[model samples]
Target: MATVAATKPAETPDEQTLREDLAAAYRLVAHFGWDELIFTHLSVRIPGPDHQFLINPLGLLFEEITASSLVKIDLQGRPVGDNTQPVNPAGFVIHSAVHAAREDAQCVMHLHTVAGTAVAAQRDGLLPLSQNALLGWDDLAYHDYEGLAVETGEKERLVADLGTHNLMILRNHGLLTVGATVADAFVRLFILQRACEMQVAAQAGGADLIHQSDAMGHKVAAQGRAAFAAGAGLSWAALRRKLDRLDPGYRA
Candidate 1:
């Protein structure tokens, strides 16, 4: 497990900040071309004991999502309020599994991109073909695709497969990442998706690829973890500035 920076309970972010941050994640993911139309989901748990969360409303493109447009739901995926916005039950099935088991996973992101899903289809998961892949080498887990993840029973198996890893590649499906904050999760997902993209490109080259040794990979993994933990927030701040300049509506 990577060393997560200590965040005291008193410093828990308010719901408004969490809402804007999570909304920004959706915008950024869409900006980077990682969104699968209006299909995939990103969620952030509100600070409380209710197991409540904020997620993009169904039928909205990631780019169209605004903080005020986010839907609030309970653990069972039911809307906490009037339930005007559509919520995807499949998203609930996938996200609730992680939230149930991992208390630290305040924000969860899952996506289906070409490189990410292409790598998931392979027999071997992410290969150590690039430094980006090795950064998350030790923290990655694999879960076999079990058809549509709408069945509630699959949650148990999903959580079991995830175990302690923060990154998971759903075989023949897509990618999933968890984080203590939306910024951390977004950064982790960015590196993970890049790693998969690099692996796919290397494999397509039809040439021998360099695979780093486990001993060296572990050392690199440690450094990667520290760097991400230390700098992800800074990157988020910078990116959020860009987002603000581009369109500040996401903060609504």
Candidate 2:
């Protein structure tokens, strides 16, 4: 019989927190059924200047992930430590491009959720039809799909397409969001995903849509920013608690 290898020890506090947050995000996505069979990705920046980032191991379902199982990799898409698990190179390419080009992107999330992809395929793409859509008004960018996003040469174009936007609709593909913190990114994705779902459902009803004016959109977006800021701390704390209640094993 083959012998089992020894497992690694527990993570340090800082690393532990990062892992827990990342794992929680994964679980949250999984709970919502947004995960695409390990095809999508959510990445958090490492705290140091080593330019390392953490991502989910390729074979594990999002719900199966624990804090210790997240893999750390350099900006160049190379594994930073002794992570025996493989990563999805295509997903890494998209993430690495953003991380390398955008210093502000501390966490990057990409998803192929049904609603998001449905919106991406629409000609207008994320219409300003709802309050949630306003959160991305003038803030959402678009990047035309270029195959599977695995080419190193695509990084430049991807960055160019993203520009200064915090959210992007990967045209004919899916959605992407970046933030200064994990909570920020996750929240942005949540709003964007909801907006997409609402749009698709509204379109299915065959009712004429009411589009918000640019001024109204901007005003609502500013309010959203304030609201998000005012409640973010508590909200994140609550979200972490929810994760703990559901699966305290993530912290391990």
Candidate 3:
């Protein structure tokens, strides 16, 4: 059997480490072509009672995000500490709602990928047309798009739409996923994105799509539960290694 990398350290990570992880997620999103220029955002909540989180600074592309450059901000979306980097208001509005509402949502990733938005536009939303789709089938939620997500009032509706689910498709907007860790959230987004891509490709052929029955959905869910029991640490480790080879600047 091949050896795998460790998922995380034994001790709780400090703010700096969290910054690096979130930065890696940004770079990975860019690397995978999921980034929409300087739009869309990924954030991780700081472990404290102040309801703080780290997000990409405005006006920078995803590839430009670095650990040291991540801006820490308060719940009201004000930059914390001496960091003067301005954050995207839309990013804060969406991310803050999740961080404040759900304790398990330590990390939240939202993207405006072509396939993701395409699926969101479809009446059926994400279909169980592929294996990756099954991974999120059980935990999926849907939120109707409310303009650009800049209003504070949208936070209440966004949280209400997200509810208890970790995976969400912001209708006619894009994809969103939350997790207990950065790795978990990234992996969930990966699955959701790939599923959307596959669905779009399959639909283009104009062929009748194969839909998995409810029984198969349950079976895949069980198998996924067993297979990913160790969580997304190993996958994250491999991706980090790949990033190290490609561009390790995010760690800076």
lDDT of each: 0.86, 0.85, 0.87
What tens digits encode model 3's per-residue C-alpha lDDT throughout 68-170? 7777788888877666667788998999999999998999999999999999999999888999988766789999978999999989999998899899999
Across residues 1-252, which tens digit of lDDT does each residue of candidate 2 receive? 112221254345776677788888898899889998868899988777788888988888888777778888888777766675778988789999999888999899999999999999988898888999998786899999889988888889999999989999999999999988888888889999999999989989998989989899899888888777546556778888988898776665
Give per-residue lDDT, candidate 3, residue 131: 95
Q: Flag clash pairs in model 3.
A: none
Best by TM-score: 2
Using all chains and alpha carbons, the TM-scores for the candidates as numbered come to 0.93, 0.93, 0.93
- For model 2, name the residue pairs that clash: none
* Segments in model 1 whose C-alpha atoms lie over 4 Å from true places: 1-13
How well is each residue in 86-138 modelled by candidate 1, as lDDT tens digits? Answer: 67888989998888889999999999989999999999888877888888878
Span of 10 residues, lowest total lDDT, candidate 1: 1-10
Between candidates 1 and 3, the one scoring higher on lDDT is 3
Give the winner by TM-score: 2 or 3: 2
State each candidate's clash count. 0, 0, 0
